[model samples]
Target: MADPKPALVLHLATGGEPLLFALTTEESGKLAGKLAQLVKTGAVESVTTKDDSVVAVNFAHVAAAYIDDLARKSTVFGMHA
Candidate 1:
């Protein structure tokens, strides 16, 4: 079976709910880099999620962004196994 894809998680500064975009590890890395650049410029950018939905993100409003690689099995205490 193929491995599960990772998700790109974005937390906004407005402090509501976070945005999630499913993608592969490589794609997540690429997007993360792009977000970093956008954040530096405080630009508004559009990102395509796994569902093929386009989301417009304002970099100035983004607090944090990361990849959620769910394939990594975790222990009871949330430590990677």
Candidate 2:
């Protein structure tokens, strides 16, 4: 069988339970770059997720982001360690 694909993890601190989303490799890189640009330049009107979820948050709410390339233990859900 073939191996599973990696994901891009976004960690956002929402004051309560943090908001987490898993993005694809391509999306992750693009998001990272855009976030950096927004931090340096201006704001982003809106953004979408891998699951087609739309998200709109202030640039200051972005806590952290990472690319997870490790193998997932289960195939049912695209989750990683």
Candidate 3:
């Protein structure tokens, strides 16, 4: 069996829950670059998730963003550890 894919995690400066998106490493890298550019220019961008959900993100509110590539332990509720 193949291993599960990693997720792209975004932490907002507004002090709420971090946003998680299902994305490949390559996709995550591209998105990270885009986010950085948006931050530099103080712009808002719309991102499409793996699930086909469109999310509008304001880079100014993003505190941190990274690809979560760690091996995750399974939980009872099927959430990532």
Q: How do the candidates rank by lDDT, highest first?
A: 1, 3, 2
> Given candidate 2, what's the lDDT at residue 71?
56
RMSD of 1: 4.1
**What is the C-alpha local distance difference test score of each model?**
0.71, 0.54, 0.67
Q: What TM-scores do the predictions have? A: 0.66, 0.47, 0.61
Candidate 1 lDDT, tens digit per residue, 1-81? 458777777778888777767875656766866767787777887776667677787888788776676566752335246
Candidate 1: stretches off by over 4 Å: 24-26, 73-81
In model 2, residue pairs whose N, Cα or C atoms come closer than 3 Å (at least 3 residues apart or on different chains), thus clashing, are: none
Residue 31's lDDT in candidate 3: 74
For model 1, state the Cα shift of residue 52 in Å.
1.4
Clashing pairs in 1: none
Candidate order (TM-score): 1, 3, 2
Please tell me which predicted candidate would have the highest TM-score against the true structure: 1
Model 3 agreement with the true structure over 3-81: per-residue lDDT tens digits = 6566667778877887887865656667765666676675787766667677787778778666565356753334466
Write model 2 residue lDDT over 29-52, tens digit each, in one string. Answer: 677656655544535435566687
